[model samples]
Target: MLKKIRWMAVVLLTGLVMYPLPLMADHQGAGQNSTLVLEPTVVTAGRIKEKKSDITTNVTIYTREDLEASSIQDLSDLMLKEGFMVREYPNSTISVAIRGFSTDTHGNDLSSSVLILVNGRRAGTGNLAKISMDNVERVEIIRGPASVQYGASALGGVINVITRKGKGPFTASLEGTLGSWDYKKGTVSMSGAVSQFDFDVTGSKSSQGDYDTGSGSEYRNTGFDSKERFSFNGGFTFLPQNRVGISYSDYSGDHIGSPDYLSANDPDDYVNHGIKSYDVYYDGQTRDDFLFWNIRYFKGKDEYETHDGAMTPSRTYWRDTDSQGAQAQITAKWAVAQITAGWDWVDYEVSNSNTVAGKENTYENPAGFFMVKTKLLEDKLVLTGGGRYDEYEVTSDTGKVKEDDNWSFSCGAVYKITGELSVRANYAQAFKMPTADQLFMLTDYSAWGMGIWSGNENLKPESSETYEAGIDYTRGSLTGSLTYFHTDFEDRIAYKSIGGGVTQYTNVQGGTLDGVEGSLQLDIGAMFGWDWEIVPYGSFTTFLEYEDDETNEKFQYTPEWSAAYGMRVNHVEYGLNARLNFTHYGRHEITDYEGTGATTLGPDTVADFSVGKELFDMNKFGKIRLKGEINNLFDRDYALVQGYPSPGRTFYLGLNYTY
Candidate 1:
């Protein structure tokens, strides 16, 4: 491990040394300004709009243009292709890991250490596949503890999806696509502003048959019958400084085949899932622009059903989850300081039904939080601090109740070394409450000599304290960042198998995780004053240490290293755009389902390329374009998860029209 770490560090240093620094001569006669441009703005880092360069945390943003240039079908696809640490199954189940901490793809929203938000509210589902990207304007990801801004389930990080809003003149678009494995997709969207009212709406549907592996063999039951989505965002501005808006989204997947692992192929298992969410909000500011405030209320539902037709009598299991929440916040701005305070309340109810008796559980939480940001030294040094307190209650149908409370805090600072460079460090404390299933579970198996499986109401919430430091550099045609982080985790909840065939949940000593993450990008065309824009980028993560304290064993499913490299091209004169990227995952350990011990999985790499070109434009009518994509260019046979193999080489062609 030490040797590997040293080798990676040496390689990174060599690359940095070989890259040329920005040249003043390149900009002097190019008719371009030499001044640095303001970095992109983000809201998830501070719970308010702020320049990315000013934030004391690590953040990644993906704009609509970036999405359009990719061949991804959904959030899961995007994350996997972008080299984010994730485990995806053939049935569309995906789990994301950040800094060695992960979310549960099959668990409820509240159970995950990572949080997913839509427009700054809970998405109500942990499955990324259920979140459609068709109506997203952008995505903001904060890669560290965020409990001070959001409440629980933000121990690892946060992913916020910001939907599109209407602006400019009325416009509409229609798109259709065809791909391998009998895949078909169609979409329609309209957006515009009329007087004080603005709106954006979109609808899409897609279907696919089973896909083949790299060996040209069919991976039976690895496709979905159909998937449908609809989303709308609209608002009315009653005053110049105030607006009332509403948003709605719906997603459904019908007959999604769930194939067993390659070792245990079961062809008669499948699942159906659906998710719906809606929210209403009012945003306003004082006439002087010194005070800004927002209030919102949201509700959502998630349904999941699975069928096991291979059983003698066949069995079906179903779960329904309902969630509702409200949030209000106010911010006051001054010359060199800003303050924000907020309150939040939410409730979740889940019910399960199957061949056995039905069961129901409820969880409720309320919280208050505050944050302050101050600048000094001629705005070259920025400081931020925040804290939150939450009280929660849980109830089960078996007349059991559990209550708990927690507090989180964070502090950070950023210091500008130069106009184009900065350094930052942060410390944050986060926690995740015990889930209802872990606190109130009760099952009897003594008749079969399995004794009892029970939960412990005394279990405490898991907690972590993280420290991170990083540097950011942004010069003409060049951008880069590097960060190092360490986390101390404690009181992790796990099930223990005691003697007498008894199993019970309890809090156990946790572990530590340390890693380094970095990214670099440069635009060759802009640097040399060429006619076209050409950019090359690369990013990677290397784990220094990740292990459990109790057994001194490394965590499962976390690779020692992962990387992504790509290049993008654009020619505005010809209305042409292209992208080629490769994502690589290093060797990792995976749990052996067929045995009690663990097993190691080999490394794998996947490549994708996409290109689009404008065909023609008819005045008063619309513009037409054609796009093509090839995924798995090398046709590599690999599995992200132990048993679920990813599809092989695939091709797609699409036609789009806009007015």
Candidate 2:
């Protein structure tokens, strides 16, 4: 099956690449100054609004248009479709890998190497599948270390989810969908602006039953009972240059199946999870436009409960985490330079129940950071430098305390060679503090004939330094970029088996990673001066090397290559839109749990297609659209993880009403 899919993938990719070659020459100068081209702006790169072409780091942006054209339901699905390495289990657990570093899919925010943010603040959880896309306006991704801009847990990269804001006049939307495996979903949203006030609100509910594999076999306990989500963003403008706003978001999943592996399937095991967040913020600028300032305070909570009916007594385990933080920043602008300074504070408290020894821990972090940017030579050359200092404190209910401090720094430069091309280089340092479980926990499971686990109080923080360079070009109906990066990591923390049935956490020599990322897109209709729109796009990542110094092994789930390519068509006059996308993943090594060697998986391709058509318009009432989608078009049998197989071909149909 794998071999067959590989052959089909090669043929499909070759045809896509060759189809656009013949028309390239004829459309070179057709739309040189077309208004269809617009540069994207990002805030995750420098903690301030800046055009992608002017930033010194690699970044990726996905606008609302991109989201509306796909069948994505959450962040994990979007990342996988965009050529990033992702690990998805049959039980709906998901995590992302950037470069060679990855997030902890089973851990909290503080334990992850990659940071997830909502409107520029901590999201409180590492599991990407829990984050809904109902109210997301745009997504910004920084592909390299951002420790100098953000604080800890940013050793790999950063992902910021920007929510929608109300504007113009009052409007509302309603949508419903049904798919394979008894899947069903419904959503409602509204937005409006009145005088100086604006607001947006959304709510959704979804559920599904067991799903089948590509081979037509049912995968038991691979579905969830139900999931619910809500989001809101509103604000009032005053004094012309200042605004205050409030934001709230909530997510809950009940009776989510947790079948670990096909070989060890447990039909009666499940989990319940919930997350809630609230924020209040204010932003303003002086009338002279010389100084700009913003401040925000946020609070959130995450809760999980697992029920194990496979056990004799039907055991239950639970964990509850609470988090709160505050952020304040100010930027001073000058003729040739701009300086930004900020302070951040955050605290996390975690408690566990139904354990042999109930436990509780708390973590606190305070930091100050600053950045300076200067433009030279008629604004053709841009230089930026920044640094951050952080202090961390950890405490346990057992009367154990630990304290640590660290500093991070970064520098970068961008030079525009022409009106449509630019070159950039950057160097940055990042770090991650030890988690509470790794620093203060000790469990003696020897009485149950299991290995004992102990934490190390003297473990140093894990750190890494990265160097990267890239080139970006944008002109007319074409846009593209290519970047190469290298990272050296140190003081990696890993558990090692000592004598007897015992394991202990310790710092080990780290590893090195090197990779290249590239993307390209072209609007065929705009380039040919046509009345309709047709675009072809592709993005890919290739790993040159990924090695561990201690074990001389490549990281698991780090694919050697991955790519996403497709085409889109839109005709406004006809009220029609369509899209076709293909996602391919290359083979990589994985740990062999049953043996001492490594195993391999992947080199699979999956295709998805969606289309929508406007049915009618009722003038002042609203418009109605019919939409449909098919995922895993070919039904190729594949598994992202060794024991968990992905779903087979699935179909969905929906209707959207706007007013």
What value does the lDDT take at residue 648 in candidate 2?
94
**Which residue pairs in candidate 2 have backbone atoms (N, alpha carbon, C) closer than 3 angstroms, thus clashing?**
none
* Residue 234, model 2: Cα distance from true site in angstroms: 1.2
User: Where's the lowest-lDDT run of ten residues in candidate 1?
Assistant: 25-34
lDDT per residue for candidate 2 within 446-556, as digits (tens), equals 777767888899999999999999988766566677788999989999989987787889999999888777787777786676767898998887777788878889977
Task: Summarize candidate 1's per-residue lDDT along 169-206 as a digit string, tens digits.
Answer: 99999999999999999999999999999999999999
570 Cα displacement, candidate 2 (Å):
2.0
lDDT of the candidates, in the order given:
0.87, 0.86
Strongest candidate by TM-score:
1
Which residue runs of candidate 1 sit more than 4 Å off their true CA positions? 1-20, 24-29, 32-38, 310-315, 354-359, 444-451, 594-598
